[model samples]
Target: MPIEIHQSDPQSYAVAADFLNVADVEVVSLQHEFGIFGGNAGDHILELVQRLRTPLVTTLHTVLAAPDEAQRRVMNALIRSSARLVVMAEKGRQILQTVYEVPNEQIAVIPHGVPDRPFLDPAMAKHDLGLADRTLLMTFGLLGPGKGIETAIHALPALVRNHPKLIYMVVGATHPNLVRHEGERYRDSLVALAADLGVSDHVLFVDEYLSIEDLLKYLTACDIYVSPYPNAAQITSGTLAYAVALGKAVVSTPFWHAQELLSDGCGMLFSFGEADALSTAVAQLIEDDSLRSAMRTRAYARGREMVWPSVAEQYLDVFSKVRFERRSAGAMVIPFPASVGEHDRLPPVSTTHLASLTDGVGLVQHTKFAVPDRRHGYCLDDNARALLVMSELAGLVPLTPQEDQMTLT
Candidate 1:
């Protein structure tokens, strides 16, 4: 259901909240971005969330290192209202803990999801696109000033000087918001820049929004992928994630996501807006076939964890845990024995259930009656909880032979 974007619509918020409360959702996953909700810094979201009766799992799309007063207030309120907070990058988790003083347990770091695709030769895809002869360098996503497309365009002259057949592909249409106000002015300027730099033929702009199939096609066709975003605090980037997942050799600016994902030799990074650095990195990767191939191999290996299936399981785990916790919160509680002797009289807790749920990765997050639910996958939180329980149990009672074997496993 759609609610009108009015900054202070109390009745609208209340109605939306009431609808959701009665909708019988097990858990609500909210995607939080600053401008999406209506309010000063999206504070209007607080009104609706405050009225929610269902468990809330908020996925924060943007986590600012330095939030203004209004943004901070809205974020704090949202944090209080959410059962769990999700961020796509670890830097976001760090910022929430350090800057906002949020407890680490409240947050989960899940990478942005990417399509499951095979690592294929760029030549095959380039031939399919009728550009087999030229070396392709691509940057995709909605075209806007913040994308730093001009830097890539500026770097084109230096890149072309070495790889004479190089063609920089600027894919994707102008951002709707930018088009609404500026009417393709940003696209026009990039074109003009290319012309002025005397590399007009080397820069190609595919001015249209692309479907995932087409996006992947373009991605596969490119020999080198570049993300020149100038914002250092950009916490997540779906395009960047896709590039890494598709095994494309990447050269990106040091945005938060890039800094984390591109680390450990998975990809290359350059300072934001540094055209010379961008050109150098791209040239280095292009010149050294082994280096580029190794980067692709490492990136593909890392992408294994970020694939859609793995990410979906992670989300299911979070949702299942939230629902379980909510159900548990309202259930009857048994009072514990007061004295040590009283506790000693109680039978030792069985490790059977815990052992069944645990696999090599960690403890699975949920179970169906007596069976472990592997579809829900595992999470760090549950593993930590299991460790704590086992530590306490070891001190309280000697493990049975079977339990000892389970623990060793």
Candidate 2:
């Protein structure tokens, strides 16, 4: 459903290869390049998903449109497929539903969950991380345009005058593509803005991929977590979960993610895209330690409910529901009826595309230059290719090459 990035491993790749081999359904993940996929394997999954003899489910991990053309094509293909689309936030569901016009029933929302761990004492964590002297305010995520760092930086100018000891930890490296596309221009812009605001020295830029332990140490060290997201369609953010799990006071924009996460004093929210309001929230947290403590307590409770096992079980339940529906319907494969076939011609695709739907290891139909590859695989790209080679594993659309493309039923 989304990118699963692997930085290293030849043998570690086996786990994914093994998964695709036995999975009851073909799972296609979009956004192959976020270091989520091994290599070209993600692309191969798109071709291989056609051969799976079971249900197909896709997770559009990120907003897929414009900028990334190839990924956008894959996302469109996923939507066009019989596979169901899984989104992470209600707002994301709204985007695909109201804006993209995907059927409401076709999309699902399941928030990302964190581990249910006993939170480290904030004092202990701060001391351990050498951050004891200062109040920590953090924004952790791959820094990018939609990430809302600018708003966070702008809010900081006013915030620092009142709470001089406060340190803003800017976690996460600039996104790889962003660096490639603009050559550290975005990073320079952020640095300049911080400098202009006279809080550049207070901003800590940890410019490396943090390991799990490093991540936890820094996460636990924070006194407060800030997610100043400007764009609201972002489906889910793992940092948001991590913050709540650690019981840190959270101050965030009232985006859909915050709506789902900021419930139960787990944190506080400000108006969307308002820097001054964000400043006010931070000032409130800093000025009132009692309020911060109360928020921290509630944040941990929310995190406890979001542990990975619990969240993962939700997906398992969804899978069970999908499987049960197929079984009760008495057929594993249900065609999109000929009556709805006219809808395929209602709209036009920019290019001629091919799709092959199947159940079991069979070529149910055939047309054009495309044929089903017959091996269902994991969606991560690079690993998909390298892993596929090691695993040593393994369609047809219809009459007239199925030229009518945009079909929704």
lDDT of 1 at 134: 88
* lDDT by residue (tens digit), candidate 2, 206-292: 776788678877888888899988866555777887888889899988766788888877788887789899989999998999999
**Per-residue alpha-carbon lDDT of candidate 1 for residues 1-409, written as tens digits (9 for 90 to 100):** 5444355676677687888888767898898999788779987888789999999999999998899999999989999999999999999999999988889888999999999999999999999999999899999998888898888999989888878899999999988989999898889888999999999999999999999999999999999999999879899999999999999999999998999999999999998899999999999998899999999999998998999999999999999888878885569867885777666586858788788787766788889997988888878787787888877888888978755654554
Colliding pairs, model 1: none
Give candidate 1 misplaced runs (Cα > 4 Å). 1-10, 328-409
Worst 10 residues of 1 by lDDT: 1-10
- lDDT for position 12 in model 1: 77
Off by over 4 Å in 2: 1-46, 63-76, 80-83, 93-108, 324-409
What number of clashing residue pairs does each candidate have, in the order they appear? 0, 16
Give the root-mean-square deviation of each candidate in angstroms.
11.2, 21.3
What are the lDDT figures for the candidates, one per model? 0.89, 0.68
